[model samples]
Target: MPDDFSWSDFIQRALPLAILGLALIGAPLLIFEPEGLPRMRSLSKELAQVRAENAELTRDVSKLRAEVRELRDDPAAVERIARGKLGLVRKSEVVFQFGKPR
Candidate 1:
């Protein structure tokens, strides 16, 4: 054994602590932390929700385009839509109205 401990003893003690400090500091970036983890998960959920809504909107757009094409090619579909949406009646047809209580 040596009578006096030198700088090597201090360095050997510090090396483990330095490694532990680096692990602590780098863990949050490499692994998920409690504070930021929930935010990242929420962002992923929101992105999924937005993608679903986008898909729904895209389907709605395609459906509307198909309806527009139908209205352009089929006069019967146009007439049906006009009668249903605008309450249009034929030249000799009489429409009866019944009131319902709200």
Candidate 2:
């Protein structure tokens, strides 16, 4: 209300409030800028990929554990693996070999 008031005085009083307002509005925009958004999206995609890989690894581990349990509890599994992988036959079984004609 004083007649001696000037524009500089008004500016001095309002500068702190102006800075506070700009900080409040700009901080979030700065954090969510174009570059920041893409970086966040990339990170989210990588996290999802890692989760999928972890799930696949977990399934593989479970399958291996089940195979181990089957081999420990059942002798048939070992025989099957030997016959299929190693081509082993019983002692009395006849083995035949076939060759392609030249």
Candidate 3:
């Protein structure tokens, strides 16, 4: 009811155009901008790191499996490991060591 304001004019003339402009702006944001922007790049970086770690873990698993197979089927490998790691020897053999001066 002020001198320059008209509620009837706003409802009849401005509201529909305002709604149309908002829809025009919002439609592209909802459709293309979401898919073509930040989330895809973030997910791509995460996927690359996961693939690299998966390859390293796969190689580790393969090596462990080969060692396990050898330990299961090879007695000579087990004896070599015991001799090197545990310092084991036959009852008649003696081990001698000499010390180095600092």
Instruction: List all candidate RMSDs to the true structure.
Output: 5.4, 4.3, 7.8
Return the TM-score for each candidate structure. 0.60, 0.69, 0.61
Better of 2 and 3 by TM-score: 2
Q: List lDDT for all candidates, in order.
A: 0.90, 0.95, 0.89
Better of 2 and 3 by lDDT: 2
Clashing pairs in 1: none
**Model 1 worst lDDT window (10 residues):** 29-38
Off by over 4 Å in 3: 1-24, 27-36
Off by over 4 Å in 2: 1-16, 32-35, 98-102
lDDT score, candidate 2, position 61: 100
Judging by lDDT against the true structure, name the best candidate.
Answer: 2
Local lDDT at 11 for model 2: 99
- Candidate 1 lDDT for residue 86: 94
Q: TM-score of model 2 relative to the true fold?
A: 0.69
